[model samples]
Target: MTPDDLADSELPMLSAAQATHLRALAAPHYREGHQYSLESLAHTCSRAPEEHWPDLVAAHFDRLRQASQGDESAEELLRGVHARLLPVDSVPSELLGSLRYARVVADGLVFAYALDGPTSVRLLTDRDVERAGLQALGEAARANLMRVPVRHEEVGVEGGARLRSVYGDSPFVAGQALFLAEVAWKVVGERLPDAGALVVVPTRHNLVYHPIADGSVVDAVNSLAAYALGAHEDGPGALSPRVYWWHRGSLTSLTVIDHETLTFSLQPPPHLLGLMKGLVHLDRAGRLATRAAAEPAGLEELMRGAAESMDRLVQDPATLADAFRSLVSLAHARCAYDPDVAHIDTWDAWATATRLGSALFTGAPAQECHLGEDLVWQLPAFPAEPPADARGWLDALYLAIVCRQTDRIGRLCRVPSETLRQDDSVDEYVLHWIDTLRAYFSDGPSMDDVVEKLVATIETSGRDGVTHAPTEFVNAIDYQPAALFHRLIARDHDTFAKALAEAVAEHGGYWDGSAAPRARVALGPLAMASLAYDYGFPVDPAQPCLPAHLLNRQRLEEFS
Candidate 1:
């Protein structure tokens, strides 16, 4: 530990290639201000008896030399080195009492087994590690072992390794987790008591732990992950974004945050999340059975309560509402300089706010609505236009529309008792808005012209007392006429013709002689003339707007 010892240390000498590789591997640690010397790193490598020292150093340096520029291959190469030299899991009876040790050697990794009889360290070879099936274990050990000194306080002992700290000074990277899990299994396994270990990751870097129940090793690990996610700090980077159940050398299960937005948007999966929340809440409330396993009766009752609450949350709509409200509030706070909607709660309030939220929050399309799932059942009637009432169904509907949730939009579209009202065409308006959104947001067409033509068509139809036909005609072809006409107005006749041809093809050839051969065959001339007039393009009188139909009729005559 002293400078004199460091100077006197007889460490492994590295070949030119090995030294270069070590330098490259050590670059990151050096950049982060870790000044590790070859001798120091060598000392840290698994200690071995004098006779085995040379081979161990050589193997350790060889491992370093094999690493690529970025050490991306560090794990694989290190594992190879260990597999070659370490005793396999199926070892001779004589070696049963020995213990294997893993350590980071400067930029490299090293392993050695201490013989029980002689109390001497025997360096492991690559072949030995492979035979032992200890590659994953080695990888885990090397990765999780802290390179930097962490401010740690040992909380407990599990298996052979000590529970060093509840939370680490920094966040666990993707691979360190594998090591932690491996170590946990090695040390804790099924011996973990009923009060599961509590692992709290306030940030990706820091993790805190306490015992909440007595359980097996795997259960304890699972509980730790669940608690980390449910109980961590709020907002991005403040909390662990996700947690995983690590066992058998890899992560088997992980529950992500933002279940609704990220997984199932229409409905969030509540069971696992509820279980997670239940445990964390129990910890927070001091209601857990004991610091370890709960007394049988008390633990059972508490668990029953947790289960009931989870089921109730799944069945109740209130949980959904609360989660959405929180997320919307967060979004609003994020947009502090220019928030579109004020925070509103309660079913009635959200109804009216849905409309305002849609209009004001029109920064970009969101993936999900802030309105809760309960809004669907308690939805009030929507007036012809979006009502001022926050409780009206249109409020939620508008928000869904603006958020660009097509599936939710479809669901909301069916929720209204009456699809239309006096002077207000609810379905038509929704369809129109969806088109406007797709066009504007996707950059498929000009928004100004699309809106202008749609407005003109609606106004013209209203003035002419042509109720529903214009809208129906527009919807039948899936909102392409306006876009086509916009092109036509720009004197892009070629594009218009090409688009029209493709549209007809998609709807089946116009003269198929079916009841609805063309999607809007009955209103072909009217729809064409309406678009032409709206955009200031003159309709060609001699041309048959229903070209396929005209051609088919002539073909029939010729056959006859």
Candidate 2:
């Protein structure tokens, strides 16, 4: 049944003429198990105004008839085929027969291929796939789909949440969610948050998404769900009436359907629930950090707020590694804005990040890596696999180095350097820096070799670059860490201090008007400074990004 049929009490009563036209259209393709039964046709056209039923039915069949002719050359077919997301039940079961014609994508959705023409899109049958000699039809269709032009409008909602709706006259707009990461990046550029996004493809022409950055997601979910249900009910081309969580290229349905009752509700799975809780915690911590920075006299009260947020986050074992990375950013912001009052707060945040990072990455208990203690010496076994993204690997490496756990560093370096090169999403320059740092910390390369590789990476990154004021450097974040790493390994103390200040200043300028807490400070540069300070290198304590207390591990010494 179509989405509207699930909600309506009865399908629109079909006139004799409409019934005859539908049957005549279905006759050539009619088989016992096909989806073209009289009832199914009525359901399909039910959402359209009754007056338009005949045209809609005839147009759908016309496209199918054209698709069945299959006389186009393989190259022409490949160029015209595009992936479409549709409700699973909308496609004929007979067409799906063992041939990879349709594959289930989300809970009630399927990824199907279609041939696009000027006036209509035709669903490809098994015959179309055979004619094209395609072994991986889905892959080819998806590749072609990405070439479609993407356009979106940003809609700001209540509670500081923002939604980006990708909509156009193009029939392929809603299917862009299948390539969500690339589409989102294209639409929002670097502004898309690292925690991923919450998406709803309400109708075939509209895909709405909210990047998961703050506590607003709690409300955005309900808002998007209501929007989806309404749009699905009013559609000429309805897809799934559900919300999905898109993270690291994987899509998970966040809407649960109770088929028996013909009802559905939004309920995030365990992993997504954990991520949502993490976002909320980070949001609260960020507010407290901002307040503390702006009002240093109320530091104690703000610290209490920070403690409360941390307590709640600590209680959830599913809190993601990215959350801790944000926490580290908040900690560095406190040091940057009000170092004198933030000494203890900075240590607390960093210690918590290291403790949580150990637990999340190594599968160790948080208690084992207690706060206010010398960093744990007995490092747990590092995972055999590297993290899925550059930031994750960097977070892991930062935690290991800050805690002065060289054994963990060695273990991290052993997890296949080739894995770092696999993800095309990561900048090649960033990967070079990560590999160099891993080699430096593992003692696999001499300090000279490390400096040489890092310098080359930074110089190459800046060669075609625009310089941010205060320094002749590239504005990209990926290369800043490398620039700092080069300064440190070469022991160029003056340039290191100069670069640190410039990097911190550039960071603030880059995210100047943004509300994301992750924008407040440069975690990467601070992490690199922490390494230098640990090695007895002279680090200017007052550098805004490098919290002096954190660099010295002051609270660990005092409290222990």
Candidate 3:
């Protein structure tokens, strides 16, 4: 007889209403390649005849609905079910074992290909985990797995049995170790002997389960190592290597594997545990591990504070500048007082880039009086005082410049630009400026001469000239300050002069009852030219320089 014609005891003990609701939920999934249904779940649930199968199915649907609404605390849901339903008995075997289908975070469902025999299992990779109520669970599991301090240098397919043979499913590598082990057991545990299985774990890459062929964890590890090194004739003398194992379901380390020594350690080393714990917090912050690796203790909290402060003051340019200045100053003071602070040099570099970049692209002051703020931030940790260690200071300056330049390039890329008249054309001269600055910062024989030239350029500007009137100018706030827009204006002063006139004419003669805004607009090209020149880029006065054009016009307009 068909599934519908089965006896009442063989089918799900659901009321007609419950069966109808399940069919409605399972209908859409059935069309989308999901093979599970009330009938199929009943058939699989019958295998564990002692369990209350209907209650288990109801609980699964309840959890799925909650998970779909963004509550993905699966463990909590399971605990609640255990406490409420069938409280006298332990958790049902149907809940832990085969349930016809297991739904992951997205829209995919894992199905039991065989429930009673070899217990083949399969999960759909094509379905969307986010829509299927498994995305958060998947992400959390993936994040936890990434923090596992397992390193793999090489990955080769050798004599390891196909994962499909054991589970009728290909190897799956994403998600937490515990979750993966659960999937493995649900898929192939019935075929696996009761003595337990030997799992070959190649670091964080992939896991292959070998049905209980070896007796103990030590023997299992040794057998895997021998298989890994069996191809000695293919290369130089292949040596025995350390590998990991999954025994009964828990991850364990197998280290110090040689001809004489096979040390089986149940716990990961202390240092690795510390690093992994730090990584979990960093992952939550959406940051890379470079800074966190050295100083993982409070970096996430510090970054959160900085982000919150920035969000509040971003609209108020002056307030933002003040806050950034304070942060840079504090960081510099800390570094100077204690050079041994974890990754302080890197932190200083980041702070300096932020400070100088904000001043150039935003409207922060950069006077010689305030140059100490920048200098102090750039100073590297030297073993002795200067004169005897002058080179150290210079090295710090070089590194700081590189950091600043890279930061500026990234900022320019993110900002929008309306100045490019042609899409295909680029401003090549800006690239020349970057290369020129790099040369000046290099350790060549003419480095001293180049340094002198750069110092003279900044000194000639004088403290007032370098950081004076521009601080009062209104930031355009429209575009990210990029070289393309600046070069477009500087490509030909006459064309730019006409463009400025056109902009002013379009905006009703650039008079908002204030010369400050109009002057800032008119002298925008000049400000860009000044930045280039200050950074040691050569600008010919006779050429079509926007600053020179603006200067001559300012005298005529009597705006200065």
Candidate 4:
């Protein structure tokens, strides 16, 4: 570990590309959080000057949100939480503008995992990270977090040749997280030092489906992540660890993050949002004037009117032509100052009113169901490379989960009585017969065995006898709006991390990490990007820069 050892040391000097990663890992020197680095970043072709690499890019985007504070020019749009746009031009638009809204305005997200081994499986939450505490979990995590120092595993199918394009001082996960967090904080602190409050919170939630119940084993590695987010020196921004995981047959553990006004206004497109408000006006007009006298006739007449009104609103086709322009105008008015609505004043109000009316009229009966947008949940995307150190991934997952909950909320005007409230706890939901199920799923050698093991996992975990948790965590596999949800949003694996936890706690997976095929660092996001492009899901087109080679996971298009 000494300089003299650099000459005689087996530790290899980083390759040119690796050096670039290293520089990024080391970029926090000018920020308050990081100490100085010995290696010079100036001449390496690895470093970008500090100005171009200004601290947290999130702040800049957020600043744009603040600037649009009083844009009262657009009245109808500021009226409600969502729009009521439908894609009835005979077919859907190739690139959806909706997904882009979720991608950018996503308040927070969570991605969790249920790791399985020969012994047991356990839940890993991304939301409850405590940085220092996790950092103190000894060498394994330290080594993994600073993985930039080591060579990446070869993942190409053809041969074992290493991927030399992406390199780092240590592993890209933690090292980059620390760098970004550090620099981002300093920059924000500098920009808004006196007027606003600044604090960083890491959410705790688990992603990953597993049935393992061995607390001793689970706590050992999982606590590392918990500590990282939980143990900050001082509160910086509003964040906390959030996570998702799978337990038995359920998806559990969702996270929530504080949403800035701009991001809050970007979700819930018009397709499913055209219900409420339009009816409010009808209510005032005493439109349901003959409910007592006509009963079904009155209801039927109301439906006919609502439909005709909606038809006129769209059928004429002269209302609004560009959807994106409408959304942009809406985002500014809503998020900049974060005010409450006194009247249906914004441009989006017309749409929200229609949605409100539709929903209110449709739900006159008990236990009734109304259709909404199919929700596609996602796990967290690691800011740095993966396998993300548990702490970093958990934090990202926590954010992702919060975003999912926001999505869930967007689909609901008011949560049903059965839905898990923000007050639910993990212990009360625990399945009792977890041990038997965990043992049952341990040896399935084939896919068939994996299925049997999974079924056993569900049965055994459910034996805990806990009644009615509601559709708190509905399975995308069986949800009613599954197709449409997939059309708009795709699952981030971490979104369901908790779904497998109880099952794993009761009965573990049949295989271990060593048995499964290895994954490429590029695997998850690459697949996501391909899906995004193919289906035309909306994503923020903003390009994120790193210390390394230009381009961001291909999410940001390359500049040729």
Q: Best candidate per lDDT, number?
A: 2
Model 4 misplaced stretches (Cα beyond 4 Å) = 1-107, 110-211, 217-226, 230-240, 243-560
Give per-residue CA lDDT, model 1, range 1-560, as digits (tens). Answer: 43433322123233344444444544543323222235334343324444454555566555544433222243443432311111122233343333334432111112242111112113343444454446564554354343422344544333212232433433222223334443334433422222223343434344444332211232444445544545432312243334333322332224443535643111113332333333443232222212232122232343234334323433553333232232222222222221222223222222323333332222113222223333222222222332221112332443343333444444444332333232132224334433433443343467675666466544443313322222222333334444454455566656666655554544333223222112222222323333443344543323322322222222111100
Write one digit per residue (lDDT tens) for candidate 2, span 328-352. Answer: 5545445545553245445656665
Q: Model 4, range 344-462, lDDT digits (tens) per residue?
A: 22213222332222222122111111111321111111121122111112122221221222231222322221232222221122211122222222343454543443444344323
List TM-scores for all candidates, in order. 0.21, 0.54, 0.20, 0.16
Please identify which of the two predictions, 1 or 2, would achieve the higher TM-score against the true structure. 2
What pairs collide in candidate 2?
A: none
Considering lDDT, which of the candidate structures 1 and 4 is the better prediction for this target? 1
Worst 10 residues of 1 by lDDT: 551-560
Give lDDT per model, in order: 0.34, 0.62, 0.31, 0.24
What residue runs in model 3 are displaced by over 4 Å at the alpha carbon? 1-436, 439-491, 494-529, 532-560
lDDT of 1: 0.34
Give the per-residue lDDT of model 3 (tens digit) for 9-28. Answer: 31334434445544554454
The TM-score that candidate 3 achieves is: 0.20
Q: Residue 63, candidate 3: how far off, in angstroms?
A: 21
Please list all clashing residue pairs in model 3, or write none if there are none.
105-129, 105-134, 105-135, 106-129, 106-130, 106-132, 107-128, 107-132
Per-candidate Cα RMSD to the true structure, in Å, reads: 23.4, 12.4, 23.9, 30.6
What TM-score would candidate 4 get against the native? 0.16
